[model samples]
Target chain A: MMVSLARKTLLHEWRRFLPAMLAVSFATLLQLLQAALVLGIFGGAAVYVSDSNADLWVGYPGTQSVDQGRPIDGDIASLLEMNPQIESVEPFYLLDGDWRGGHGTGGVSVFVSGVSTRPGAMMFARVLTPALRARLAYPESVIVDPADLNKLGVQVGDTASVNGHLVRVVGTARGLRALGGADIVTSLQTARMLDPAPSDSGGPTYLVARLRHPAAASSVVADINGHSGFGRYQAWTAPAFARLSVLFWLFNTGAGAGVLFLAVIVFVVGAIITSQALMAAVAASVNEYATLNALGVGKRSLRWVVLEQAFWVGACGVVLASVLAALLIWLAHSNNVPVAMQPSVAAACLGLVMALVAVSGLMAMRSMQRADPATLLR
Target chain B: MPYSNTVIDPNPMLVAENLTKSFTSGQLSTRVLDDLSVEIGAGALTLISGPSGCGKSTLLSILSGLQAPDHGRVLALSESLQAMDAKRVEAFRLHHTGFVFQGFNLFPALTAREQVQLPLQYMRLSAQEITRRADEALAEMGMAHRQHLRPAALSGGEKQRVAIARALAKAPALLFADEPTSALDAANGQIVIDLLHRIARNHGTTVLCVSHDPRLISHADRVLTMEDGRILDDSDRGAR
Candidate 1:
């Protein structure tokens, strides 16, 4: 009966409560999209290092993120080979260049990652599926993500000029969505050839290190970090590098702070609207609450009723918000917007809305407690 | 002092001793009840009638455990209403007392049946028993036909009847009514008064009502009249 009282009150005042429900729904939508935007940017920042088939990453000492890496001596691969825990090292070459597609697309900024194709030695190249991997082996061949299809306006078998060098489109890959416009994957020689450098200018920008035992990556990283005269190069366990990359975008840049500020604004606005709506509903029924108190209903029971009402309104709002958020996410996805919605992100958003509901319910309960049963005598 | 209405029952259902209550606002204080004592017997319809603000309602509130006195104590069913904490007072009211209000304070969203069943739900009765008691209470109040109607859909008299049913559904040992018929017409008020009489006579429930309506005077077994926060007259004793 205590539980049903809340349900009954909500059902009784649903018309008046609709505003609260809608407020909660709108709040949920804001919370989800805001979280997704931040998570998407974070994901984009770390994708390059995370999708690699390496247990550790070797980069320049000041490289706060993978994208900020500077060129290192390619001979470090031979030195790292001496480690007992070392498995294989793949030198990775990354460059940014303008691309001209044969399919009438204008110049667009694109990033290229060069991967070693030596048998069992291409760690970064493992990101491509087997078919794309085989197709990328051809000379002057490159692979792009499916999202790049519309931007590059070139598909499989099409030709694209990267920095004035014509490269054939071999195949496409997944999870390679780019942060800085578009990305392409090609063999090491082709990638180096496109940007011919001084013959003595060391090696690739970074090294992808596979470990014999993945758990020993920290020890390997420590050993590499301790190596003398390695010249500005830093080694990291893969997870650490990924976290660093995410943190670089999140704190090192103003974009993360801007997104975080907007999310806070959205959360506060939604919470205020929801709390006010609930408070008004409770205020209107305060007389009935006093009568209940006079009838000997416990304070806890009355408190439960208000809380249950808030929960019902919040739950309804979440369901509605989920639908709206899904449609918005789908539209953004189709438009190639980088709003990522992971299951964990959605769960977090839901948890935030529930917290809002609980706070509002408790606030309303404070007002309910002031209801004097003596009012019934009047 | 103890004022008698007929022979005072040796075993009283409720007793008040020098109960005094006052209200203050913005540096002004008015004594609502001034050291007045009263006793209510079991199984009788006791009416406290007086002009507005004469403290009849205040006395009812104190005696029923709805409010505490400023300087006195109330003993009901061998328990101290003044000494109990708020939670215990609420529990005592839930198990031993019931109330019918002048406003017919029905939840607008609940059907008449639901309004009556609200009190019984807290009693830990089986669902069937709750339904049975609710239905019987509504039937006794002549509200059976309109049990499914919400308060908004019910007439003034029907709403009052539903409130009465809500109070009576718990089968309380002591029932307190505050101007229960104030909002109804003469005929409807008479109907409600008849119901109160029936409840006291048939169910052995102590019914204490505070009202200004003189029509209630003839039906009450004992009528206590008040003036300036003091009992001015007891009909059985002919004087205070």
Candidate 2:
């Protein structure tokens, strides 16, 4: 009976309750989009590790993120190659560089990734195909993501200066994007040539290894770390390293804090607007409530009616938000805006929305106190 | 001529003794029901008629347990209303009483049939019995054909009839109506009064109504005329 009454009233007076529903929908959409954007932005920081084919990454100790990699002893590669589980090991050079585009276009900060030009190299194996690797084999030739071409003021066949050394843009790739700066992809030889410091000053920034059996990566990493004979470095499974990078950026950065604050504000504002709208709706029907009271409906029963109404309102709002969020997410993807939504994050957002609705329903119960049967006689 | 202050009945459903009620507005206080006493019988349509502010509505409120009297006590269905707590009073009302108001306070969203079924739903009746009672009450009020229409679609009289059917569906022992016909046209008012009369005589339910309209005098089995919070006359016209 409570369900029937609540539903019929909402359907009959839909215009009156639309504001409350929309308030809930707006809150839900904001939470979902915010979470997606946060994941996408932070997830970008780990693209180098995630988009590679490496089963294990051996980097300098305490390397918090892939972009923050330090030079590790090149001798570490031999140690990895000696392991029975390791099929191949390659040196990966990651260095910060300043790019000066041709014709005085502009100067931009960039992360230079220097990898082997071998067709079967484990480093960036998924992104640098055979053709791109062949192009990078040319002297001082580099690759950049097409999306960052304008940011770096360069186009294919253009020449640029990296750390005061001239380099040619041989091609563009899709996954070579970096956080906080553009990415420049070149061969290990070119990167050594472009370096202002002596080539032998430090070894490669990190060593990446491919395993004969991918599933043995965790045990192999454990064994490598336990043996301490491998120089001053740490080894991690590729997934663990990627997750470490993402978590570092998400929790240890100011931008991440700002996104968290925005989420709090969305919840507060959504609760206020939704509760007020629900209260007004209840107040509008106070007379009908009074009539019911006069007919001997108890206060407990009346409270249940309000709760059922809130539940319906929240259900409808969630449906509306799902549709709208899907469209918006598609639009963001088309525009190359980084937005990622995991199933777990979406479920958590849904639980928050239901909690918001429940809080609003409890607040709206105060209006039932006005349903005094004595007022009806007057 | 000597006027009787109370009606004599063999089967009394409501008895009030020296009921006193007052209202205060800032510094001014007005007495609404001044030490009034009455015995209303079962199976009769009783009307308490008076001008505005004469306390007829207050009397009905006290008799129906909607309000507590300041000075005296009321007994409805042989249970002392003042002796029970608020929850007990509500439970008693839920189980034994029905009400109709001047505004025909049917929920605007509900159809005629839904309105009739609302209180029965509160009673937690079986679905089959709820539907059966609602249908029976609507048919009795001649609202069977229009049972699917909402309050907005129904005419003033039709809305009132729905309100009455809502009350009647509960099969309460006492049905209270306040200004039930004041909002209706002459013909619709006639129809409502006749229905109230029929509900009392046919169902053996006590129908107590408070109204200011003198035209309702002819339809009531008894009329208690009031002015300034005191009953001036009680006349029984005999069963119609």
Candidate 3:
């Protein structure tokens, strides 16, 4: 009887609750996507940050992100190396190179990163795996994310030219997208051959110095400025560089504020739907609640029923949102969209939905409690 | 199909001492049940026959521990009704007291059998026990065939019988009916009154009925009339 009664109550409120639930679920899905993208950006940042091995990046102190392919020669690298606390300074062949391929498309913008032959075996330990290491080890090699495989139209054995310097597609690693474009990692030797600069000096455009402590990047940077002949490029920590990337993304694309504004819109739409459903349900069963109370079901029990109903609403909404969000993400991923999915971010999305559910519940709780048990007597 | 709950005192079937209630609508005040007292023997029907606005329902609720009297004490089966807390009172009502309301308070979603099992939730009984007791109660009320029907599907007489079956399913030591026949037709009302007398006589259960139906007075073992919540007329006293 109880189960059936509960089932009927569910049916009765389905009309109002279902729509609100879907709205909430869609909101949840959207929020999840936001979380996934944010986490991916953060995760990618962490991975790149940990790999840099430098205390500080010495840029021109101008833009937030994008090193601008600034070149620092061997003199500064040697000067940083002479520091007591400095371990070693290595320059990379970093440039904004364009790729020209395909049947119709003329060119594609890309960041050509020329890293050390064996940069930090400690940090790139995963990349050093026989399978992956073999790919990056080849002087004629290049790597891109799975998503880029379609755009670049290349496989493991395929070859492509980076700024007229042809390279083989050795392997594909997921992620490693920089500013929605692919990052092509190549050897310093290969970078020297390809870049319109000297390679024996160290970095073609960007110079990264590794320190014994790593934290002493500031002092090491100063020593490089004073002693090394080339001191135009500034040094920065990996995290600082990441913050620069975010700043660049925010200012350049308007993605952050746009997403946050969308979230606000979703929340309002969901709350309005949920409030209407709750109010209608309360009115429909006002007398029923009174009868239940008169039957000795206390206010506390009554409260549980309302809360349970809210939980039901939240659960339904979240599920619906997940479906919608997944569809949206898949659509983007299929259509070559930069939507990233992360587990921690999905959980955070659920948390946001629960918080919204709590707010909606708070709005309806008072009316549920004013059941007035004596109403049945009338 | 018999289920028993231990009555705290287990001596007196029902007892109420100095029960009082007051109703005040702004400045207008009416003192109802002013220190009224009553005691009825077990296994008998005590019909409280009173005019309208007599506070019969108020006194009944107070006695059932659903409502607390401003000045009174209720000792049911010798146990102090006023002593138990809200939860205990509800449990007491669940296992020991049967109630038949003026309107058949059937939960629209439930079948007739399920209506009989509502009180069993308080007992926390097994599903099988609840089912068996509900079936037996329905059978006793001649509602065995209608067990599958909901109130909306049943007639007035059938609904009343279902209500009685629900009350009887508890196997209460004390049965309370507040204007039970007011919603039924004359034919069905008489049938219900007769059923109440039969229950008290056959099961040795005390029945207290509060109603204005004079026809029901004849079926009661003892009848009392209340004016403004105070008992004024007693036919049993003349008989005794």
Best by DockQ: 1
Q: Please give, as one word, the docking class of candidate 1.
A: medium
**Alpha-carbon runs more than 4 Å astray in model 2:** A1-3, A53-58, A74-91, A116-126, A130-139, A192-195, A198-201, A207-231, A234-244, A250-253, B1-11, B227-232
TM-score of each: 0.88, 0.88, 0.69
Please tell me which model should have the higher lDDT, number 1 or number 2. 2
List per-prediction Cα lDDT, in the order shown: 0.83, 0.87, 0.69
Tens-digit lDDT string for candidate 3 (A1-378): 443444456664477567667767777877887766664554443334444555655544353564444555545566556667766556656666676545444577766766666635332334434466455767877776666766665667787777787888777765556665567767666666667444454544655655687666666556655543455656666666766665566545677777678778878777777766776666667665554455555556666666667777898778877887888788876764556776766887788788777777667766776676433342
lDDT of 2 at A377: 78
- Residue B29 CA displacement from its true place in model 1, Å: 3.3
Off by over 4 Å in 1: A1-3, A78-88, A98-109, A118-127, A145-175, A196-201, A209-233, B1-8, B124-129, B237-240
Clashing pairs in 1: none
Q: What is the lDDT of candidate 1?
A: 0.83
lDDT of candidate 1 at residue A378, scale 0 to 100:
58
Clashing pairs in 2: none
Write candidate 1's Cα lDDT for A247-345 as tens digits: 788886777788668767766776677778777876777777788888888878888777888899999999999999999988987776777877976
Per-residue lDDT value at B34 in model 2: 93
lDDT of 3 by residue, B84-149 (tens): 887777667656777777767666667888777765655677888888888898998899998988
**Local distance difference test, candidate 2:** 0.87
Candidate with top lDDT is 2
Residue B36, candidate 3: alpha-carbon lDDT: 92
